[model samples]
Structures are given as C-alpha cells and as structure tokens.
Target: MQSIQIETEYVTLGQFLKMIDVIGSGGLAKWYLEEYQVYVNGEIEQRRGRKLKPGDQIEIPDVGKFEIIE
Candidate 1:
C-alpha cells in the first residue's frame, strides 16, 4: 500500500474526501457517503467524522488505497 501524509495530526472521513478531491466539493462527501462507497481497512465506513489516525488504511473502489502517514 502507498501512504499519504496529512498536514494535521489526524483527520476525519469527511476531511479525507476533501483532501483527495474525491468529490467536487465538501457537500459531495455527504452524498457519496449515502451511496455507501467508502471503506476503511477494507470494511465499509459510514461515519463521516470517523477519526483517521496515522497507519490507518482507506480503500475506495476506483481510487485504490490511501494509507495514512505523518
């Protein structure tokens, strides 16, 4: 897996959506979440505010893996 650095100490699921430009805007994160297309460590993650710590792995079907790093 590859790693992506976060400028902050930690981040949330919504922050990730914004970070990667996964959606056109922040509001799109909510809409995408409703589609249930986001995953963490291979399992579907439904919480928008789920705390993402260093070493966490997030998987988006078309986007591949995004492993968190300092």
Candidate 2:
C-alpha cells in the first residue's frame, strides 16, 4: 500500500485524489467518481466531499491502494 501524508485534520476525497495525482483538478472529482470505483475502508464511496483522515484506507482497483497518514 502507498502512504499519503497530510498536514491538516482532514482532506476531502477530491483533494486526496489530487494529492495522489488521480485527477488534474478538483473539478474533475465528480466525473472521476462516476467513471471509477473508489473504495473507502472496503465500502464503495462516490462523494467528492467525503472526509478522509489519518488511518483511512482507499482502494482503487487497477490503479493502486493508499493509506492516509498524518
């Protein structure tokens, strides 16, 4: 699994995607969510505003696995 560090208390799923280089801009979060399957802690997630904090795990099939860290 890959680790992503954040300085804030939390990061929105949209911001996380950008941090991981999955999307070019925050505006594409909606489209990306619709086009791809994003799993948050084993459950499917599609909200761009979903808050992701430290210890959270994200899995994107065919893409990669990620973990949020402080």
Highest TM-score: which candidate? 2
Candidate 2 local lDDT, 36-66, one digit each (tens): 9999999999999999999999999988999
Estimated TM-score per prediction? 0.86, 0.97
In order, the Cα lDDT scores of the candidates are 0.85, 0.97
Worst 10 residues of 2 by lDDT: 14-23
Q: After the best TM-score superposition of candidate 2, give how far the Cα of residue 38 lies from its true spot, in angstroms.
A: 0.3
Stretches > 4 Å off in candidate 2: none
lDDT of 1 by residue, 1-70 (tens): 6688988889989888888888777667778888858889878998888889899999988877889999
Clashes of 1: 0
Per-residue error for 46 in candidate 2, Å, reads: 0.4
Assess candidate 1 and give its TM-score to the true structure: 0.86
